[model samples]
Target: MPRTPQPRTAVLASADLSFRTRVREALTGLRWEVQEAQGGAEALAYLEARPCEAMIVDTWLPDLEIQEFLAECEKRHPQTDLIAVDDPGPERGPERTQARSPRRNEVLLALRRGQDADHEPQGDGASWNGMPEMTPVHDRTVVREEIFVRGTAVVEATRPGAEPGPGTVRLPELIGEAPAMLEVSRRIRLVAPRAATVLVQGPTGSGKELVARAIHRLSPRANRRLVALNCAAIPDTLLEAELFGHTRGAFTGAVQGRIGRIEAADGGTLFLDEIGEMPLALQAKLLRFLETGEVQRIGDNDPIRVDVRIVAATHRSLAEMVKAGSFRADLYYRLAVFLIRTPGLGERPEDLPLLVERLLARMAEQAPVRRLSAEAMERLRQHAWPGNVRELQHVLERAAILAAESPEIGAAEIEFGETF
Candidate 1:
């Protein structure tokens, strides 16, 4: 009898999740078992532990110098073939080429397929790629102490506005340097890629939606739709229909048959905002869907299976509500599998300046960017932010309007909103 060949192992090293995903998909039927590494160091360590047939390194590595890393690999792991992906830009390419591998042509073909797929149109006719091209991770960056998990790496931000380095995943929307803020970033990176249900708890206007969006963007479902529903915004009578689909004649409207938010978010992320506001009766049905991954229409007997990640956010305390018999204990446990709390503005006062800069820059699209005078900044520092980041945004908007034609906002332009 003829001998059977074992599948070849390949190591993929890159900080870009989308790139890794595309490459992995391209190699699906190529008899290759691909292992992932977020940086050069991890790749080296992984190769040391287990010999592989080939290793494909990204153009840039987050932890180690690219040229140095390639040299080290050449010297230490001569038995393994090395292939490096081209840089995203046209001006520069991989620093050095490695000796040709037996399967170099096949691997290069797969890399081309992955690269082409990245630039092609995705779902909903949207040209947006899964993730923005991240700034290259340099080897000389300083490591900041872990803000939350022991193993998580957080590179210190070199400037006021800087991109996160290798092994650290920070969304551009999440802007803050406080320990609490960093902890939130750490937790998001940890849970975003998984199928786990995440419960984001925090005070009102503390950027819970931002956290939810971040989770969706970083997850495997990034290319799909991110369906969101504000549980508290809809009336109790219509909320059920909004969540679970209803047949044309299921209810009084009977105008048309339509799917609910859950079904719409199939193979994507379903963001339920203000989840605590959902009525207890409706919570039972939601729990069933979460448990079974099957949702039934209001008047239909057949249930539809869906694959989705749930990211629920709430301003109210579900634990307290459960204690008071207002929320279901079982549902609470299911949703709270991975808890992420967004920090209030008061908790991270040092981030106020950065927040102000970001908000002002956003507002600049409508009008000229206005600078805050020394006294105006002082006044902002003095007031207590009762409404959290939302209130700050409102205050800045008002000040920007009040400043009008002026290039800078003065103390008189600053105004505080009433506490709720």
Candidate 2:
């Protein structure tokens, strides 16, 4: 008997009902198990709960901005394939008619033709002196399809080893071979075995969370859960309940008993990202937990003891925040038992080529990978990655998409702009 084919998993994010229907139909034909989301935030939430093999995101969404959504996707699911789609406007003029042609078809044609130019009109048109004319157009359907296929293949090829079993959660493996990365790895190994609470400081997008995960994976609590909570992301009102569990009748809409993150990571590591944003009152509670290894669930009189280790990270300078009185000095002292400062992408320019190579290799699974021009690499190295490694990944991902329809990524394709 023949074995059944594994279902291709995908998350489709778009608010347009008709467009979503069409996309779903196309993916269904390709034997994909399609999950739908109305916007970027919803898409991200879906991905966080159950990561898919590939994500098809519309450039425009109501809830979250496009670039931000893509960045989050890259950070959370680096191995998953990403395909961005843009709408083709009315089919009126010569350009409009060409734009209306399926973008997936266009991308596929470009890849097949080994073309390095953007989509351009071909053949004769109504013109003075009856001359043939060609013009560039923007619909990239063929390219999108090619990208999807290539990305899916890469995800399969580089799927991380099976999910770490209970008491053995796997963390994000840092991706660089540069001297900076070597030092970071050495630091992680040195601090992993000890029960010290670690503080990871870096600029936003510098992969602070990734560094935290590596520490957890290498630490004595490697066999436990590595629960991560973004302090800045959680609202101040509910931050307390999120970090510490609340009883069924604790507060408004508290319908059921819930286990907070600290307790959930009982025998593992609790990674508090953007720890500087944690509220002043909550800081005291956290400090107490660290000192006594006990957490008191909200609305409960008793404190529950847990054996979890804490790994906190932040992009802000806590020392400055402490001076400003926005953050607690005592809490910082408790969390910073060990400190590992992560270097930004610009700080380690030597790793650009290796990082670019790995990104292209992953991108190749979605389309024919293209080689970066020397000028392109030089230009990339020159830019100050304020968003750090995350920004670099986005730039490369976008370049890959642009180059997937061409044979090479040129200086123009390496365009860098302001990213928040």
Candidate 3:
């Protein structure tokens, strides 16, 4: 049998005439349905009333701080994929700085792979495909010696449908040499640059948000904001207004006009966490947004424009939900452009020591460094982490606080949970 055609995607962006025109043209070429939002309050209302596979947001809105908007989104609808954008200039401030250069060698390594020489440096002022030349590096010795640093390259230049490298995020302190984690890092590297919708499926506390953040940090849109929303935390009735903004007097509590999450995150990423819990009625609306990048606010006639990318996560089996008719199949197809499954802690037992050590180091920044005993390490490996990394962090934090008097934490200090 022939394969079915894919559903269209929604592109939410700002009302700036030129910007909106450019976005519509770009997405139209990709066969995506485009939606428009004027600002944060307007975008949120539209998203709540209509659903989209993914979204694009701008960081610097006329109203509302982009980070604060993402926080609200995390609290309201967690399953939507959010991409944030910002002015490409240097005025983005501290948050932009932290996210921009997540890993120093990522770009350099990507360029190096295209070179012909094993250790030979590309000539100074070397340019690629008409793009500006990369920063000139003079140290040949360092380049030769550091070429094969511990891990394999997480990304590759193979065409689509090729075997993907490990698709996971790699944090500086996240230990473990497990193949699963390596694969996750590879996926992050591959998808970060492209504007595809990403579906991150994993159990709660499994670092789904962390993976999402890693993608944004490494992506072309890193300088922009990364907005996150949680689907389960917010009530159904209020969810629409929260996602797509409302005009003044649209509803009972309409003291003033409001901008939604979708509009607020234009020009960046919008992360929707815990998407499986989204209500059925909202699913259809979301499907509409994904199909057409236009959003009609509650009691409003005009549709605003916005630009964003979507990265969604969930622990539940959406397939089951689709069968039960709780989730929309069309929406599922749009969001699953690239799916990444995060391995549970139990699946990567070898990483326990590394995880513990890193957590301890982070804690030490606030207090003193503490060590974990062999017995404790063994127990951690043996036990099942149902809550995954989030659970592990909590346990370590508690243990650290309790072991403040001692330099080391033993198995006795560890609180064990039930097996999965």
Candidate 3 has its poorest 10 consecutive residues by lDDT at 141-150
Residue-wise C-alpha lDDT for candidate 3, range 149-262, written one tens digit per residue: 112333222223445334332432224557776666556655765678899998787778878876775454655677788988899888887777789999998988887777
Q: Give per-residue lDDT, candidate 2, residue 153.
A: 15
Could you arrange the candidates by TM-score from highest to lowest?
A: 1, 3, 2
Q: What is the TM-score of each candidate against the true structure?
A: 0.73, 0.58, 0.62
What is the C-alpha lDDT profile of model 2 across 168-280, one tens digit per residue?
Answer: 21112666555565556546654665678899998888778777766664453554578999998989989999999999989989999898999999888899999999989
lDDT of each: 0.76, 0.67, 0.63
Which pairs, if any, clash in model 1? Answer: none
Look at candidate 1 and tell me the lDDT of residue 113: 75
Off by over 4 Å in 3: 1-175, 417-420
Considering summed lDDT, which 10 consecutive residues are worst modelled in model 2? 141-150
